[model samples]
Target: MPLDVESLRSHFPSLASGIAHFDGPGGTQTPRVVGQAIADTLTGPLSIRGSSVASERNADQAVLSFRSAMADFLNADPSGIVYGRSATQLTYDFAKHLSTGWGPDDEVVVTRLDHDCNVRPWVQAAERRG
Candidate 1:
């Protein structure tokens, strides 16, 4: 079945403004449902994720729910899901972790097509390993 572009776009209220958004690394506009969820969470009782208090429990549940949803969508384990502030941060972290296992014989390959954010982390990690 062909995907309905209009139907998908309808969920994003920002699209109605007719401004084309080509940037994803800087962060894409949130869909109405996601925006509403974020607003609700921010407006609701919030505390560090824990089970000691109601606010803490609420925060904990939000984290678990986000991880669970991501896991389901990615077909991965929820426990393995590590949320980062951005793709660059995650790339840097993973590069550093993986570089620790690298030896002199191992090579680090980065393409020119990769964004600077993606390339710099690997290069830095390789330098650190050396």
Candidate 2:
């Protein structure tokens, strides 16, 4: 279906306030279901289980759920997926892995318009490896 602006707006409690939030580059908001899912994950009974078989199952299910969601979102293989706090953090982690075995003569190029998060980690890694 086409973008349901009103339906999507109903999900975000933050949008209910009269305040405006245009701090980021993108002027967008997440659906209420997304926020509710995060809240449920953090505060739900699934997290309070002791180290028992049931708890282990719950934890495994949570991981599988996350992996499946991520794979679907990115159209990527779940096995190749690695989760990070943000794209910057993820890029840094990938840079560390990909930069291994680089020689002193190696050079790296980073974009000017990219976030500092994306550039800083690769620069630091190149310096260390050099």
Task: Compare the candidates by TM-score and give the number of the best one.
Answer: 1
Candidate 2: Cα lDDT at 34: 73
In candidate 2, what are the lDDT values of residues 1-130, reduced to their tens digit?
6999878667766788856565342214655677677777766546433456665566566777778888999998888766556676787888899889789999999888765776889999999898
- Best lDDT goes to which candidate? 1
Overall lDDT per candidate, in order of appearance = 0.86, 0.73
Would you estimate the TM-scores of all the predictions?
0.74, 0.66
List pairs with backbone clashes in candidate 1.
none
Stretches of candidate 2 exceeding 4 Å from the true structure: 1-29, 46-54
Ten-residue stretch with the least lDDT total in model 1: 20-29
Per-residue lDDT tens digits for candidate 1, residues 5-111, read 99999988888999867645544667888888988998899988899988899998898998999999999999999866688999988998889998887888988
Which ten residues in a row are the worst by lDDT in model 2?
22-31
